[model samples]
Target chain A: MSNVSATLPRKARVPIFVVLVLVGISIAYPILYLAFTAFRTRADYLGNPFGLPSELTLQNFISVWNNYGIGRALLNTVIVVAVGLTVQLLVAGLAGFALARYPVPGARYISGALVSVMLIPSQVLIIPIYLLLSRIGLVGSLPGLILVYVATGLPFATFFLIVTYRSLDTSVLEAARVDGAGFWRTFLSVASPMAIPGLATLLVLQFIAMWNELLFAYILLPNDQLRLITPALAQIGGRFTNDQPFVAVGLILTALPPLLLLSFAAKYVMSGLGASFGR
Target chain B: MTSPVLAAPVASASAGATGARPPGRARWRTSERLVGIAAVAPAVVLVLGFMVYPVCYAIWISFNKTNGLSFDYVGLDNYTKLLADPLLHKVFLTNLIFLISVPLVILAALVCSVLLYERIRGWRFFRVLFFVPNVLSTAVIGLMFKSLFSYRGPINAVLAQFGIPPVDFFAGAGSAIFVIIIALVWSGFGYQTIILLSGLSAINPEIFEAATVDGAGWWKRLWYITLPNIRGVLALVSILNVLYTFTALFGFIFVMTAGGPGYDTTTLDYLIYTLAFSSTRLGEGAALAVMVFLLIGGLTALQLRVFRVSEEN
Candidate 1:
């Protein structure tokens, strides 16, 4: 590996470096544009859509928050994502723990079922999920949306956690059991602590996924008053095509939580990806 | 340390075997089983309720004419109608066209990952920057691209600077699909790069060194050593990209072109959405949904088979 780069002559190095830089710019430029445009006044954007803003202002953000009901949407998103993430983690954690540590009857079948469902894209289930939710009168409710998120999220979350828990050092768990710790005690005191990195990775991943989820949230909560951040942004983007700055603000707000999470837990997220696919 | 650690299970086993302890052990074993059942029950219940049941219901409703409130037995009618639907044909063709983005993504990811693996200057920053798109919501990326490629947007502005007329990118099917493909590749290649990077990292560095000693140049080494070593990961990434193109492009299409100047860019997922919700053709939508489910399932099975074959080899 060391000599691989050294063997490249100086001339080849420059072009490779330049190509890397160009690719980096292509990735960064549009995001930077969104950020710059979000802070620009409508008039400034209109005058010079591609140029640096003459003056940055909070007016676009404020306008979107107040006029587009993005504030409410943000709150809705927070409630749904927070509650859904907690439930999904708890349920998946328990199930993953059981499958990993205990001789649960039909464990193999249970795992097979989970893995199979993980392959079924949620889009394919949207029709029936919608009908099922409506049948239970959860058609336009946050709790209903939360239920869908947790359910759809469970298969992969449980599968991931199962892999995580299974890879844990068994000696520690054995020691815990030797100390007279029962199942829940061993799980909570020993297994759970050991699996913090996995849980954290799962938390960050599921949070981002649930936060960015649109279809079920949009379809299930068709009422504008209860729109989540993503669907709200889509609505704003679709409606105000010419109001670029306003739409940009909405887009930024919608993306901010996950981006913030990514910045903080990027290592965990990347490791989680590696772990998921490494098997 | 090993003695005590090893003794715990043996101690419990011997105690259970003792004359006075059989009933107690049996009780403990039963309770443990119950606890295990209790622990796994929530996930099982949720999966049964939402996933398993919804799929069965989707299959059932695919054979009926229903609009959420009503169902009339129209056995094979929904399926036949969808099978004959020209719009569905166009949608599938559009999806096939979008599949073109998967190879583009794989190629881009391959080059980027290989370049980054060389530890180029600022590789770390580029890695994070490339991954920024993966973190952002696809809707946001879609809208950003939509704005950038709009008639008066930045892309057109850049063209004007080059003495070319502004292009209305979304005015036609070809350009609209082009814009979506660009967005998909831009946002997609990064995640694949990360995956490919991990795959590349798993390769034995000694092989590269040995290849270098044999006078294998960079391209030759990559084509021979790097490419063959990461073939499994490449296949995984391809399938993932295909899946993303099939299911996850809804957000992009929803925001960017809204399925087009006509049915020109309507992907299968987006078609299901329009049919079930917008057009209130739930029966037909469910039919298409079933078809999509089977398509994905078949793809996944094929991936597993590929892995199994690769493992055997």
Candidate 2:
């Protein structure tokens, strides 16, 4: 039961910060190098592989974005991330709200089961889900990918929201109910607003997960026109193997959305992710 | 996984179970039960439909052979085939080989977190910067590394700058797997650090203050008080890493080496992907998947046992 202080002498902090700088550079260098190189032409890269680009150019970015089917893939990604995330938040949110606030007999068991199922390694389910989706002819379709994403994301969403809702005060919900609001009204209005911070954090995290999810997207969406952004980027990389600048640009385009979002909302991302791991 | 935080909720949850007395509490309990049922039904049905059902069906299909249009029941045949297949044996060996990297990852994470927890300057910026890699798509990271390690990439370019001969990183099995391990640790280091740092952040500073007053130096205080207190979280992060080491290597392998240089980088998950989709041997692939699930299950059970034992101490 001691205090939570992290005090250090002035002289000691310098060496520790040096260590921090070393660790930070190693973690950040690959990403920064790739991004920086994308702004260069192949000749520029050959001239200096490790240094910043001599002259910035958007040619690589424009070429990859317009020509490599990234435009179509970006649309497909939007459908999956937007629609799939909505379904996940809705289903997981409602279930967590019920389990947290309601008195259903089997709710606890269901909540526990959903959370436990998340521990099941996903590769095992890939084969069967592929077969199932193929049998129903949902393979190569956006809806099929969305369904799988929602299913996979449900456990985390439900698990996190349940913990979040349980930790929330119930007095507001009680007041809303006293005003003659029905269950849906109370939950949609009171509980959800109170949980907005958590909800937004989870939404961004889910977006990043789906935006970057490649394996399932690879297996499910095999059709050329319907491929998502990640697969699109990977395919272009393989196609333009000799053109390092092209591949670099493709990687940057694919990585940009999440990196930008994360940079802006790092607080939410860190806190949300920390909350998940802490549990 | 069996920590008091996660485990304690189970007992209290049963208090609101069904049958809150139909006669006495009938009026109030009706709406509550109805809302609860309606609320949870979606998640229950979705999980059953997607996750639970598919897993069970996969186990069932593990016993049969299948072509595009036909299926034949072959009880235990798939398992027997998997058992005797030399490639799978190689895959298991490779998995063991790759596992040597897990502890290194944990150590890196621990060092970073402990330093940050010691009030290192700009730790917040470093944390966010480090975490940027974790958010990037695996394919992006994988392909970037693949290019960076290519014969003429920056790595070799730098080597040549130092007057060293050019080296083919992916030309040999050892070097290829080495690259894969580096990518594995490099990508994973950030996320694990953030988790471990949070665990460190939760530690009471008074513990350190008291120790310092008693003439304990930083290293001694870290070794004795900090390490022992976060034993639960260390176990948690390591256990989670076990699962990732087992399966998550697939993305990196696919983009980086495609398990090349004579199947050197192929893990069990990668092997299953190649078998099922590449070779179109669904039965054998399904069989391998079941084995992976069992291995992960055993690891999880071990995690819980360790977590619970630590709780008692």
Candidate 3:
């Protein structure tokens, strides 16, 4: 170990290590506090919000699940994520392949328009969408919320998939075409397989984003039954007012899914960003 | 899906009929082109409906006063009101103040990325640890900070341990902004770091090895090699980091101070949210939204231009 450390500049090692560790601790501290507080009682939390739990309890989580409606809200969130992810993949994937492979007229403009849509912040669009949805009676519904998610997730998905499809071996696609594979046939046989990695990356990114999306779900899905996890957890915070442990429990439930997702796909997430920006 | 796969072999067999190939293949290609058009139709329609049409409608909304659902043409009343509204001015001012974090976070991320790029001990673990806050919901981080900086919370608790009285963290505009900025930087560091790490990894080792052989120190190598190599990624991240700070500060500000003791922390995004929903002033909100959109659009265009030019150099 001492020999290995000798390769690095001896003078700077200690400060560099300390800085990195400090950063790591700063990042981990709140998360640990969030988790620890969830396992403690209100008295325990109020007495020492920063301290480790002397006695652990599951009552807060139980309350969060039962009264805070986290289970129902989680189900709603899962539905939104599921539907949004599926439609986003299908639409962006299909469109991306078509534009990349076939002579789709106006494909350039369509692609450019989609990418440019990212410049418009979602908040700006929400105002008009709110009005439009109200007129169409999409306000306060799960589908409305899902539509917003799909639209918001579309730009990145389509952009990534287009790049993915474009970078694929064109000669192989050519061989497929010579074998009389039509658009759908060629896409399934060639493009879809290659787009899977990009799609998976987009999936993890979108799942986290849609799961955590509060503004649209708050504005569009005003119905309690359709409320997604973030807003619902936020509501639980207010509903339980200073019942910090329960809210902490709610926060844990809200965070745990993405934590699981990231653990499984962190490498792909980073690589995907590299792919998107490196181009 | 099954039928498309099955049709492939049949179509191939038909195409292999050499004598009739010209007409048969032309017909096949025409149908293929049609299918391609059909494939992209849904996404185009979605963009048209959700983004394009809504933006046009929003422009009209900005020109009118809406009493509930119906609109009365009030000309540029809402637009001028944006200039007159003190809160609106303050919202833009707060956003400007918040913009200070964009470059700071980028620099911090660049440093962290460079450190990780050094293949430091537990680098992978550190990267993931730094990203932990980002993977969680913003509301979670926001609420965490909200609770952490409360008068009786852990931060004050720690301050008291140092023989300092508990500071009123959210009492003044400056301190409230301070806490929110800390939270923003903490929550966002992971993403920018990952982007910069990607940039770092893209740099060729030969150049760095040559620099090492030339007796150049660490800072020299980073300045000459790493910085120049990652210019594209830096530009991209800088633009994005600024855009994020402008729009996505909502969850943090909303939870931390609800725009604060005096609307000091309310960004344009949050202000728009409040005006449209909280005050039910949709017209004024729509006007402000359009202004914000144009502002973002202009700045993004300028950033792209600048980045593109530097990328050429």
Off by over 4 Å in 1: A1-13, B1-28, B303-313
Candidate 2: pairs in clash: A3-B205, A3-B206, A4-B205, A5-B205, A105-B18
What are the RMSDs of all candidates, in order? 6.2, 4.5, 6.1
DockQ of 3: 0.40
lDDT of 1 by residue, B1-313 (tens): 2323323453455333333221223334767766877798888888888898899999999999998898999999998899898888889999999999999999999999999888867787788778888877878889999999987777887888899998889889999999999999999999899999988988988898888889988889988999999988898898888888888889999999899888888999999999999989999999998999788778877987988798778
B283: Cα error in model 1, Å: 0.5
TM, every model = 0.92, 0.93, 0.90
Q: Model 3 segments beyond 4 Å from truth? A: A1-14, A239-241, A275-279, B1-28, B228-232, B307-313
On the 0 to 100 scale, the lDDT of residue B275 in model 3 is 87
Candidate 1 shows a clash count of 0
Candidate 1's displacement at residue B244, Å, is 1.9
In candidate 1, which residue pairs get closer than 3 Å at backbone N, Cα or C atoms, i.e. clash? none
Question: For candidate 3, what is the TM-score?
Answer: 0.90
RMSD in angstroms between candidate 3 and the native structure over all alpha carbons: 6.1
How badly does each model clash, as a count of residue pairs? 0, 5, 0
DockQ of each: 0.50, 0.57, 0.40
Q: What CAPRI-style quality would you assign to candidate 3?
A: acceptable
**What stretches of model 2 exceed 4 Å from their correct place?**
A1-7, B1-27, B310-313
Candidate 1 structure quality by residue, lDDT tens digits, A1-279:
453567677788888898899999998788879889999988888777877889999988877888988889989998998899999999999999987777565565667678778878777789999988888899999999999999988989999988888889988877777688999898888899989999999898888888888888889999999999999999898999999988889888888877888788878888787755522
Top-DockQ candidate index? 2
Cα deviation at B54, candidate 1, in Å, is: 0.3
